[model samples]
Target: MGDVFAAVPGAVVDETGLQHLGNPLAEQRRLAAGTALAPRADRAVIAVPGEDRLTWLDSLSSQALARLQPGVGTELLILDPQGHVEHAASVLDDGETTWLIADRADVEGLYDWLRKMRFRLRVDPRIADEFAVIGGTAGALAGVAPASPAGLPLVWTDPWPDVSPGGWAYAPVDPHPGADRDWSEAIVTRDEEARIADAAARGDLQLAGLAAVDALRVAAWRPRWSADVDERALPHELDWLRTAVHLDKGCYRGQETIAKVHNLGHPPRRLVALQLDGSGSVLPDHGAAVRVGDDEVGAVTSAALHYEEGPIALAIVRRSTPIDAALTVETADGPVAAAQEVVVPPDAGRTANVPRIPRLGRRQASQ
Candidate 1:
């Protein structure tokens, strides 16, 4: 069970005083307002443009970018020579330049890598935090236009509105009315704090704590780098080939390795969903063993008690494990039956007929 919302006179407080509820009525007002907005965390934006921008980027990532249109975005995987995923990002193009938004932790590494690879390319890659991103399901953003919500640049709207199914939009925060009034950002100025507190009292948007956000993401099967990937993971192994890899794309640093595994061999492992049986102890953290009988087949990468699906997890299991079979996930306490819910269908697995870049080298060693 999670912590309860304590009703404290005019204010709402949790057991921990750290979160001082400003006003119950106002919070309730915002909840009733029902304007859905979710924060996009662990993302950094890198802007790139120049005479050689497209070719430079295309030569680096696992996706084909020669055809990426303006006002659209595509997911890409940056890989090491060994084909291990170094980082992943959502790349957006404005026709003139491309912006790469990746996990916050990987931004530095990515920036450094891009800098090193800037040889003779007329592209510039730099971190820009002036833009803030807020998103929500399409239905919630139905009425909002591409214009700035308040005064911030509505730089762009979700081009593939139907891709996420439920839909979502990312907009800057400054122009968003009352968005700056919360203690969410770490570097808010004193003057901004009072203004934001006042805005909070006026019943603007409901602030969803990180816990609620985490639960929502897990339910959506949205993979997170911290929970779902590591240095040992390959782009294909994370079930990102469809979204991250461009099968027909030309040569890149790791293209040979990627094409080899994708077209000619099975990836070492496959990412799958694990539905925990029964109301067990809180799902174990990442790296807990997943066993088929007594033999360990894989480990849990992410786990949570979904609001709709009870206990569920995402794990990278051995490719040999039967897709339709049931397995046991080993928690600290003991083994618990976890039924496999295949997210990346087996047919889409690496063994399938993934288009290859002709005459690539042989497959790399499996993990």
Candidate 2:
């Protein structure tokens, strides 16, 4: 089942399946219209079983999952002590098993960590290697059957860009672009994966690739664990609080930092959408330096050529960088000019508004 999409004609698949089917723009259009499916070969599933699964995960991550109802979908984040995002997962629970869909690169580390954390807890976390993930909007994925191990579909519908219950939003845009994002990932059995692959190869079903889906994600200002996260990425910077962080949730590894940043401090950096100058075939690669004049302020996290938007990117820049400043991204071909669109603004945090108390024995009072 390695790279199930490899047999599809014109499909260019690497370690991650199906980069494109010759035309990325056409693929993007089909995907956006809910007419194509993307084999998420780069994603892996982890299953947590036993009765303590939900509460155990609730105690360990950023989302409050203690009372999670069966068949509902959500997400969670594992943060380091200093509040840096280390792992993130899209979560779904059937009555008997809790399934986590996560970036393939982080699965081993996350599985090991989960195993280590089960200190006599009745939870068993195992990587479900026999299952694979397929992504698409609900409409496009309706025909596909999801894995139903516990009598429930294991589809992790994305709850992005919307403020989840108990979650907070730092981005102040009235109409967030992510409102139109209807993305979901479904866990499929090996048989189902092969069936879909055969259908795609026969030209019976259209398929998009990682590149096309990523472009749509960037356009929606949706941040994903693999594309937007770095060693220093705080959920606030990426506006991930909208879907991932629960403000009043029980204490987890990095809850303190999450509270502090949202209540009294601002994130050191903020995410911004860049409308890149579509003059060349060069798109900025991840970690490409982003600059204002001669000063390097940030780096591109994700960039893509969208079907409708031409070229666009998402970058994390210093919080104090002026909103109106013109920006450039350094690529091998040279500098590409970019216009900035605010995702998280400079004034994003400090929401508590606690009044300052007067100091005791002020000069006026003493006099």
Candidate 3:
């Protein structure tokens, strides 16, 4: 069970064999301090170049990509014709071309989709394995600005300025000065999996495990592709108007539906954060029914025992459900008392005012 143990928090420490008892924050700090181990996941990079690259990608994705300048990057969502999210990616422009870094699983499919749509465009898309990607906290990334090691602007592009506040930089794989590297991806022929793992263990860079990363991401209310989205999900439902949809931008695949829903119609569902009552033995799973009294109002999409908070979750609840109403999350163990905590409220874009909800209290209760 050491492998599974290594996968979860408060399990294993670093190569020094130190163990984290039960403190998530301590583990996170240790991981950040290079004392604990963080798992590295697979990533892929796709390169797009030519005269029509920016316009072509802008036409394809929901964000306004054509306006992206070098030394900047943006997160975008690709939706099907039905307005359902298909994939999410970050695009970095290097003045001449753009590079999309996304999950390894979705790379090939995204490439195929882009190829199918490249009718007469002068753009060329190909996989680039020469580069690697790493991430760190805002304070850790001080002097690392995006520049090409190859002297080719196409090879090194700054994808951090536009999206992140000012702490992340994506650079080349070769050695650099004062860099605490996390994960490195080499080409198939020159794979350096063991070396990277050993370096991570040696405290050179912090390892961001999937659980810690997911916890931070969910806490930030960032919508991911597979976890928070699906085939039937609309961009507006996830509160992705600011990042995913360009309301004033020209036509795209599902622009009509998006416009109509935003201007005239209401989104059927809204994404919300739920704070569990902590009294029940049950923990809800994805697709579990969400209820208010006797009415089934929504479904739970994601849940976790937060690092600080006891139990929290993200659920897609019906718009009709009273925003302040008490709801219940049906878990296998039993019905867990929960209340709705709106991360991004329905009127978020309309007004600068945001309503604050009380935090949920947890205690063991009888079934």
Candidate 4:
């Protein structure tokens, strides 16, 4: 069934379906304008069924899923004890089942972890092989109905850059870049996948690729699990607290660290959008060194050429790196000069104001 996309004309299929037709920039414009659909063959789906699903997931992850109403789209992150992001999932519930769309590379590990955590719960978490995903803006997807098993469409809308209920925002920018992003993903059956592919093959529907999706995502300052995350990633570091993390939610695995960091300290690193010098016509590869003079400050996580933004990238840099600092990205071709646009600022956390308690017994005399 996946090979159906490979038959579509001009598709550059690798292991993932439809990398791009040819021009990613033009494809990005088409995708953003709702004229094209991108086959998200690079994603995996997981289904959790049973009456206990919502509360069970709410107890385990960062989002407030306990009272999740049907057909509402949200996201969650599974964090290690020290609060490093372990897994992330885009979530949508159809009243009877909770559907999770995750990156393909992390599916097996996330599924295994979910199985291990279902000790006494009635929920059955399974890797849903029968479901696949297609992505576009809500308008682009309106013509195509998502799979509705329990009278609700199984579509996961991205809530990026919005402060969800109980979530916090650290980025101080007015009119956030993601405010204009209207991306969503629909869960479809194998038959539906074939139907879409057939439409593309007949030139009845326009098809974009994952590359175009990435370009638009990067332009919107959207952080993707597959591209923006690393071993030491924290939700605050990526401005993911704007959507993914519920700072006031009940205690979960990483709640302690999440609270402490947001209230008392700063994230060690911060996310930045880099406007690369397009005169060289070279986009830095993933993992390319991001440097300020001789000091390598960080690494490029994702890079792309947008329809309007020319060359751009998202990189993780030390929180102390000056926001106004001019940066350079070391690419295989040469060093590309980059101007930093702050996403997560250096003072991203420390929301709480806790007064000192006179340093135990030593400071009483000073008054």
lDDT of each: 0.56, 0.88, 0.59, 0.86
Give stretches of model 3 more than 4 Å off. 1-25, 29-42, 129-132, 141-196, 203-205, 279-283, 344-367
Q: Quick one: how many clashes does candidate 4 have?
A: 0
Predicted candidate 3 versus true structure: per-residue lDDT over 210-272, tens digit per residue: 455445445445566657776689877766664556677777888778767766666778888
Residue 218 CA displacement from its true place in model 2, Å: 0.6
* TM-score, candidate number 1: 0.71
Winner on TM-score between 2 and 3 is 2
For candidate 4, the per-residue lDDT at 218 reads 89
User: What CA RMSD would you report for each candidate?
Assistant: 11.1, 8.8, 8.6, 8.6
Query: How much lDDT does candidate 2 score?
Result: 0.88
Question: TM-scores of the models, in the given order?
Answer: 0.71, 0.94, 0.74, 0.94
Cα lDDT tens digits for candidate 4, 133-182 = 99999999987768999998888899887779988876666666677899
Model 4, residue 278: distance off in Å is: 0.5
**Which structure is stronger by lDDT: 2 or 3?**
2
lDDT, candidate 2, at 293: 97
Worst 10 residues of 2 by lDDT: 358-367
lDDT of 2 by residue, 21-71 (tens): 999999999998999999998899999998999999999999999999988
The predicted structure with the larger lDDT, 1 or 3, is 3
Residue 89 of model 1, lDDT score? 71
